[model samples]
Target: MYQPLAYRLRPKTLEDIVGQEHLVGPGKIIRRMVEANLLSSMILYGPPGTGKTSIASAIAGSTSFAFRMLNAATDTKKDLQIVAEEAKMSGTVILLLDEVHRLDKTKQDFLLPHLENGRIILIGATTENPYISINPAIRSRTQIFEVHPLTPEAIEMALDRALTAKDGFKDEDVILEQSAKRELAFVTNGDLRSALNALELAVRSTPKNEDGTILITKEIIQECTQQKGFSHDKNGDAHYDVISAFQKSIRGSDADAALHYLARLIEAGDLISICRRLLVIGYEDIGLANPAAASRTLDAVLAAERLGLPEARIPLSVAVLDLCLSPKSNSAYQSLDRALQDVKNGKATTIPNHLKDSHYKGAAALGRGLTYQYPHEFSDGWVAQQYLPDPLAHTRYYEPKFTGRYEQALAKRYEELHQKKSSSTK
Candidate 1:
């Protein structure tokens, strides 16, 4: 049976692991543990292909502990029992639990005692944030370490090693171009497993030249990965991640990063998501700080909608650039939210009697509008009167921001009105 290149290239020792220098580098925590031959239960969380499993395997390999792999979601309690039995017989078994965030209460209970006793050194792996997804009982017992995506330089280094490694194309005559290596390294977006697999596929599928050497080109790498990083999966976790990055980039005023994520969304054909998020960012982030820019954002979104697709990206790009460069303020929505929270808490809801409708005949009998003072009838077209209910007569909301000239002017008028209201009440 032929093993996959990634499987064949699994890191057999801590020294062999690539990337994640923070955890695996010299003088790092994991490296120190391995050097001292003291292994503890750990949860390694990160995106897939970032070497969570590889790190687990390397730990077991280095420590000389019995290694076993199982899926927390698919495996039953009986499967865990088997590992427990093996730990009894072998003294200690290093169990690499995949998708550990899905471990149910029953399995977690069964595994806890074993982890405590050190009979089974648990190396839980997950692609989700363990703090949010994993049960607290299990979390409290294990040391959680985060794994990050491998850098392009790290991937390139791995590709270079794979070219000459015994299990790779060392036996066969193959020549890999520098451009091809860089393309393979980059197109996978820091996914070393994907890069290795794509490299293997390219090497195997291409025919040998007259000199009997398989020459791999950048085009070959792209063909192998089928557009790789350029193509976005709209239904995957990466989709939401990209959307989050898109909005945050704009909010942070990083125009380049915003455009990069926007381009990804565009390529994925997620015009609806792109347009909706842009509209939200315009108001929620730009708000009173740059009202005109917010209005222009809506206009750009409308243009994009009418244009649709390839042409739509043009207008969307212009809108994203504007929003990123515009002054940001969330005060408008934040003030509304503060008022909403008061209402939800049952702080105040009744309208003042004076402000109530009095156009109806029976309203006067109910004392509605009895003390009403119409602002239009006043000389200054303004009057200070109780607008809030008795319980919240002095309640104030709508705190204007001063991040831009527009909001600064609004803030000035707001203070003036507040002062007039305060003096009249006195």
Candidate 2:
């Protein structure tokens, strides 16, 4: 039977591991733990194709303890009890659980007693967030090590290793063109297993010419992995990428691209999440410039909530288009960011004494509200006064952007106030 290329090229040792040099390198955390045989319960958290299973296998093979494997997706509470009993009899059993987040609350809770007693050194592999899915007690007992997605360079290196390794492509003389390789990497999106599978499929499908050399082209690579792409799931890198693209499209004033990305998310059953995010972005990115953008987003979210899927898509499309076409300004967001930084860096100035309360007892005795002027009593219904503290009186935090209807009025009012203040001071 022919083994899959990914399985055939699986790394057998720490040195054979393709990526994650930060953990498995010489004198690293994993190396130190393995060397001292002081293994603790650990959670391997990362996306797919990052070698969580391979690392567990390497640890099991290298250690002297008996190794047992189970999948949380299928295992029961009784199954966990059996493993716990066996580990109690055995000196130290390394229990490797795959998809540990799939275990229900009861099944996950079953491992706690064993884990606390040190009966088994649990190594859990999960694609989901452990904090959210796993029990807090289980999480507290384990050392969480985050495994990152493979970089493009790492994927390329793995492909090269697979081509030349004794176990993989030994007899095949398949050479991937530079363009084909780049396309394959891009399609895989840092998934090592997917990259290898694509490479294997490309090599197997390509017809050799009379020259006896098979050329893998970009077209063939694209054909191997169907290019009918969809928006990302809510919990992974794709989620971040799609949202980033959506925001960038709006910021770049590409209404078409913004609409396209919105449609992609809506069609992928992410309408509710997309609506919520749009509402947030409308306020955060498009605040006050076109305040109506935020209202439109809220309407979209309400429409999605009330009507649900399929029918709610109309409002979602409208909201996305309105946000994209709305007058854009990030000045308020940037000003808040600067103000927050100043506060964080201990640059927050005190409130001016005139703005302090004089109605409270003994407040007027401390010169509070001594020279405060009421704007309503003035000729122009505006007063000239130091609103900010003495130290930051000249600090200009909010600079209005002249883009939308609201901002235009705000700019005029601000200019009039400054003119009145200048005349009063003179």
Give the top-scoring candidate (lDDT): 1
Count of backbone collisions in candidate 2: 0
Candidate 1: segments with Cα more than 4 A from true spot:
36-38, 104-106, 207-212, 235-237, 292-308, 340-376, 388-396
lDDT of 2 by residue, 140-198 (tens): 99998888788888888888888788887767777888888878776776678888888
Compared with the true structure, the alpha-carbon lDDT of candidate 2 equals: 0.81
- Give the CA lDDT, 0 to 100, for residue 200 in model 2: 88
- lDDT of model 2 at residue 250? 79
Tens-place lDDT digits, model 1, residues 273-352: 99999999999999999999888889999999999999999889989999999888999999999989998999877899
lDDT of each: 0.91, 0.81
Q: Give candidate 2 misplaced runs (Cα > 4 Å).
A: 207-214, 228-231, 234-269, 283-290, 296-426
The Cα RMSD in angstroms, rounded to one decimal, for candidate 2 relative to the true structure is 7.7
RMSD of each: 3.5, 7.7
- Top TM-score hit: 1
The residue pairs found clashing in candidate 2 are none
